[model samples]
Target: MQFKDQLDFVRQHVKKNRMRIFTTILATTMGCAFLIVLASVAFGLQNSLKKEVLSDDTLTRIEVYNDGNKEIEPTEIKKMKNVNAVTMNTLIQTGNLEANIDAYKGSPEVILTDFKENEKANLKLSKGTYPEKADGVVVGYNVAQILLSKEDEKKLEKEKDASKINIGIQESMIGKKITLNWKNEETKKKVTRTFTIEGVGPKPKKEWEQDGTIRISKEHEEALVQDLKTLYGKKLKAEEMIYRTTAVYATDLEAVTAINKALQDEGYATYTVSQQLEEMNLLFLALKAGLIFVGTIAILIASIGIFNTMTMAVTERTREIGVMKAIGASPKLIQRLFVMESAYIGVIGTVIAVIISYIVSFAANYAIPKILYMATNEKEFLTTEIQFSAIPWQLVVIAAAISIGVAILSGWRPARKATKIDVIQALRQD
Candidate 1:
């Protein structure tokens, strides 16, 4: 039969049994609401998980550190089949000191990430290129201030003092002179070296871009070797200060395993990005399941409502069913109609749920973020830049399926009662 006819039939049944209709409607509404809300929360949690667990840097590189108590040898690295390009380095941290050039051996933390001990760390470029010579310096905020003349410091400081003092001495710092001294190296006599500020670099971060600091180019290694030879005046035994290593873009999971094994044999700390992603996946999966589990409880209560409505429907139509049987209605047809009534209840609930869910979802599009921020205390958590995809079409289908299933399950008892109705006995009793 067409839905219009079925709807008319539904109206007749509902008008004759107001309480049953109302109960069914309430139950169906609850079921739909539960499913829709759960879907929305699942999607939101997934997005947050993605942003936090798989930050942008995960796409670019893998980090390796020297966790071994001893040294990582170059020869051991050659044994790894999955290794692509590698940059192994050591950094020795030295404390602050006063120095002079044209009168500027500034005291920015000097990081060495070069082939030679004296070469400067490779700072991320900000305005221009890195320094050319070993002793060429780059400076962050404090170092930049110290290198500037007292009068110039006051002037430049006034010009942009609010900004971090860090600034690089890239190619622009070439030919600029500064005097360098280290308190640690001072003997009874004063020792000093005059180095041209071959370049100034912007400030550098150990693992991120720096706002105020400098970087010296790798080319400074040659100058450093010569400087060290001069300082020692003979053969020198060198020590590695820090080890820097990274993994390449592996095409498969097996490739990650291979790379990790290689780094371990070489005595380096090893890990892959996927391990973190796996944990995130497990967490989000558990959250979704938990929401579903709670929502199932609501649906179960709705099922009870469905059962009561169907049972009452059977009672109200008792005489009508007996008359139909007396008029030669087949048992199969009577059973079909009763089951159809239950399905009808499900369809009504599912449709109303969908319509109302969309209305509420649109409202939530504005409200949820504010609520989440208030709960979490993160003001930036709800930026407009986020892309919230709607509930998938599949979820809509699933919601409908659940409704129909609940209706059928709850209608089974009434269907059986209708089957047992004896026309003679029904007519004689009522």
Candidate 2:
């Protein structure tokens, strides 16, 4: 028979046993759906975690730590291949450095860094531009919030509920001049310097994180050091001006591994977000494999029903098979026809399962977070984007392959039996 004729034959047989075929297909559909939904949990969690990791700035940053004896040189690190920029921070050793703008004041940590290198490292700002002059400075996002007037400070001290105190710098800090005051302990004298606010740093990624720091250019820091030395009439020790943090920015994410390796080989200890993600991916891969394995058991169970249905189909059509063989039908054609019927069931079931799986995934992703929030009363669950179930196209392909492969295998013996039926013996059946 032609391919079209063979398909017609299978369709007629399926229609004749529509109720039985429907029931078998339902079983297969449930099996496939279960497999997809189960494995989808792994896919969803992996995607969520991967997104969170990639969102971090540290993904392309490799933090290099001095191995106690040797300090990391920014110039040497910049010479490394694929290194985009090297940024380092040194804490100002002045005691109790206080920043002031008009009547508002805040005591923020003073860090000295190279603005040119920071710009190359993709330093983000919420407002304004990086410092252009030596006396210009950049303040953290929370600096304005922390800068409270004397009256507001008293209100904060009296108020048991600190949140009730609604007092923070309302005006924009850009272009405003801020005063820095620190006491020279040995000299028992106070020193003051005025610097213009050039920019504000971007908000912290985590809600709990507070960025209340003031970053100054290296020239300004050197000037301050010189002033302190002039007042003390002595030279400051070199170790006292050591860098607190050194981070190497890779040219791109793909370059992080090579740069990190190069730094480690040079005897510098390094940490990268890419390394953490690699470990996390390996863990999730194993979890997905285990879930898929567990799901395959359901498909195997469903295949047993397909096997029985195909066997019964072969038995019931024995007289028809005999008639076909007596006329002109080859044994191979008869076998192929039976196998195609089983495959039809698999394809239809797989298609329906995929649709149902996607619907279920959407419902789970939507409802699970709300349910969790209701149960735990944690507001974060409602706000945070969490995927409880995800159905990727690759997952659908895997499920289809396994379901159809098992379905075809289950019908193999029945098709072989149909081919082996003797024409006379099959025709003699009542």
Instruction: Name model 1 segments beyond 4 Å from true.
Output: 1-23, 69-84, 97-269, 354-365, 368-400
lDDT of 2 by residue, 317-430 (tens): 999999999998999999999999999999999999999999999999988889999999998888887678988999999999999888999899999999999999999999
**lDDT for 119 (candidate 2):** 96
Give the best candidate by lDDT.
2
Weakest 10 consecutive residues, lDDT, candidate 2?
Answer: 233-242
Model 2 clashing residue pairs (backbone): none
lDDT of 1 by residue, 245-339 (tens): 43343334467766766566656775666666677778867876677667667766787888888887778778888887898877776676777
